[model samples]
Target: MKFRMAKKSDLKEIVRLLADDELGSKREKYEDPLPEAYYNAFSAIENQGGNQILLVIKDEIIIGCLQLTIIPGLARLGIKRAQIEGVRVDQNYRGQKIGEALFREAITIAKSEGCGLVQLTTDKERKDVFRFYEKLGFTSTHEGMKLILN
Candidate 1:
């Protein structure tokens, strides 16, 4: 498998991956229906900017996707941090380490860009998912709170 920055053309596949049951439930619950805004946000990031959305491809097929945002921070002072989000592997490809490969590739990209740290948030109800993040070397450092605005 090869990791590459996503293109606008990949939006459909990305959304399909996101819509899978394991990943889409909460997002669907809130959004009820997915909107073009979500796709637009991802496409903007996937373009050549400080932010990036990457895809794992094998044999010209998109197998997974992850978004990385490089934040220029005052706290880090010339340092940046990467916020990784929407990591999802194709339902058929789970348990094959494709997700890990995608994450490691993102980490490499972040490091090359001088990111001081990489951060991500996962739902607390998914205990197994939390353990997976822990196994991947992420610590539960902060509580995440959100206020959704329609």
Candidate 2:
């Protein structure tokens, strides 16, 4: 698998991967005339300095993707941390350790960026994902809460 930054052209495939699962099927709209919101959001991220959308390509096709945002804060001794989100692997590529490789590459990138910590939040209902993250050395030391503005 090859790891690289995502491009605008990769959006369709990325959306397909994201919408392949049950949760994403309800949340993501994968249809003809792809939504403008997706492109707008991608452009925003592209213009942001400390944010990135990464892609994992296999055999010249995108198979997985994730978003990473490096946040600078006064806490933790003014260190920067990387927040990972939107992690997804192609349904056809699940159980192939691609997710593991993706995480490892993300960590490496975070470290290179001088991130003191790498953190992410998964849906509480995803028990299996929790285990997967734990196995990857993440700890559930604090509760995560979110409110949708829209």
All models, RMSD in angstroms = 2.9, 0.7
Model 1, 1-150: lDDT tens digits are 898887777777887787776548646423434577866676667564678778999989999998888888889567799999888888899899898888899999999988999999886665677877887899999999989897
TM-score of each: 0.87, 0.98
Off by over 4 Å in 2: none
Highest-scoring model, TM-score: 2
The weakest ten consecutive residues by lDDT in model 1 span 25-34
Candidate 1's TM-score: 0.87
Model 2 per-residue lDDT at 63? 93
Q: Candidate 2, clashing residue pairs?
A: none
Best by lDDT: 2
Q: How displaced is residue 124 in candidate 1, in Å? A: 1.7
Task: Please identify model 1 stretches exceeding 4 Å from their true place.
Answer: 26-35, 46-48
